[model samples]
Target: MKLLWLQGLACGGNTQSFLCAENPSVSEVLEGFEILFAPSITWDRYEEEVVFHVLKEEVELDVFILEGAVGDTRRICRRDFEDVVRELAHRARYVIALGNCAVFGNIPARYSREVKGLQFRFEKRGGFLGEGFTSRAGYPVINLSGCPAHPSWLSYVLLKILNGKRLELDDLGRPKELYAHLTHHGCTRNEYFEWKVEAEELGRKEGCLFYYFGCRGPMTHSSCNRILWNGVNSKTRAGMPCVGCTEYDFPRENMFKTEHAMGVPEELPLGVSKRGYILISGIAKTFAPERLKKRLIDEG
Candidate 1:
């Protein structure tokens, strides 16, 4: 299980989040895997000799992980990081894009054309790696997208790989085991959403954050709620809106305000029809069980 992790225009958030893994944790998972290199952890760019070996592909690798968008890291021993990533992809069996930046050419990509995701730039294919590119293992670049991808995501995939399992991937190259569920799945405010009870403000334990507060729980795909962050709570559980960090078009302009088409949400939940939503929302609101209207805590 030889692994090499590289970074480009990165914030290092994914590594930070990956360290928070409780289910097996980073150190535990790293046991079976030989870390040939990683920018923040096992390796740093200043180590010219190791970087040389990795770049030259002298050491055969099993997995190649890119932490941020593929950008000009500007002369890692007179070699561009983009060139390094493109070259390393050919040497490794499996290639993984470890965060939204690495998968979708996120925020940094907004500024420079040089910055691009491994296989996609936002909604479009053909990023740093073109549309037809695949790993030595014959798989496309697997994306584990998030502002900072959930630690469990990497840990889970690594465990599966270590166990020699045949993994399934979505069209966007994300692992099906992780991205199959919506952010709404198992959300604490689901009851409020079912009854069309929308939160009027940012922090409240009672209502759903979808309608007025711009929570993308309904439309965005992720297992955040199902796979709890830090093992206890999520954005909605703490009464903050789900900013839809997992989607292709994350960090939209109106992240905190719902975009509506004449009082109807512009983006309805995945597979939910607008007419049906209106009809259900109306009925649910009209007969909204008296219990839903009150605060969750009885402060008598």
Candidate 2:
């Protein structure tokens, strides 16, 4: 298997995460798979060699992984990333959409309606792959969504492929194994959330950032909290909100303003009804302790 990893209109956070993989390291799992290109790591090997410029008849790529928000225009590739992605999608045996930008028109597509994630544009509401696009291998695009995807998720997927385990994907094209867990699942701050104790401010140690800090742990789907980052903690655990970076609407209306409107988020939990959500929130709020509600300005 020859893997060709490409990028466009991105800060390359996915590449950074991929390099930080803990288990086998990217090289270990991708040992057998010849790397056609990987900008960060393969620069030593392919910097002088232009794989894309080579003759098509001389090239063979089995897996194509794209990490960035791509569109019909270009800041990197000669043509729009859409053309490059479409061409690669047709050529590769497996195509993986590497991050939120690649999977769902992340931040780059937020303001530029013309610019979009690989498959969909924000304004258009879908990608170049359209509503019914599948690879030649009969598999849909493999999506790993995140502002910067977790390294474990990427490594695990590659290992599964190497072991010949069939992958099961959700309707959104994300592997069920990784996206199955919500960001809130197994969160260390679950107790705070249950009690509806909103952290009065950042750096607090005893409250859920979701209520007032706009943590989207409840609605977003990802194993961020379950797996934990840097092996010890996650954003919520450190008093920062989840930011819902894994979901489509990251940097949503305002990056700093909490997502509460009249004391409630505009959106409810994943697949949760507003009525039920409000009821649960109410119950949790009632039981909040006075210490949690009090101004802890002097505590620290």
Q: Of the candidates shown, which would achieve the greatest TM-score relative to the real structure?
A: 1
Q: Each candidate: what lDDT?
A: 0.86, 0.76
- Tell me model 1's lDDT, rounded to 2 decimals: 0.86
lDDT of 2: 0.76
| Pairs with backbone N, CA or C atoms under 3 Å apart (clashes), candidate 1 | none
Q: Considering summed lDDT, which 10 consecutive residues are worst modelled in model 1?
A: 39-48
Q: Tell me the spans in candidate 2 whose CA falls farther than 4 Å from its real position.
A: 53-55, 72-81, 122-126, 259-262, 289-300
Candidate 2, position 21, lDDT? 79
- Residue 180, model 2: lDDT of 83
Error of 2 at 238 (Å): 1.1
Root-mean-square deviation (CA) per prediction: 1.6, 3.0
* Residue 53 error, candidate 2, Å: 5.9
| Candidate 2 lDDT over residue span 1-300, tens digit each | 777888866889999988887767777878878776787877666522444452245466677888887774553335455676777777777788888888887777766766666555542445867656667666777888888999888888877776778889886777898988889998777877888877778867778877767778887888988888867788888878888877776668655456667767876777878788889979878977777666546765
Write model 1 residue lDDT over 157-236, tens digit each, in one string: 88888888888999899999999898999898998999998886778788898888989888777899998999999998
**TM-score for each model:** 0.96, 0.88
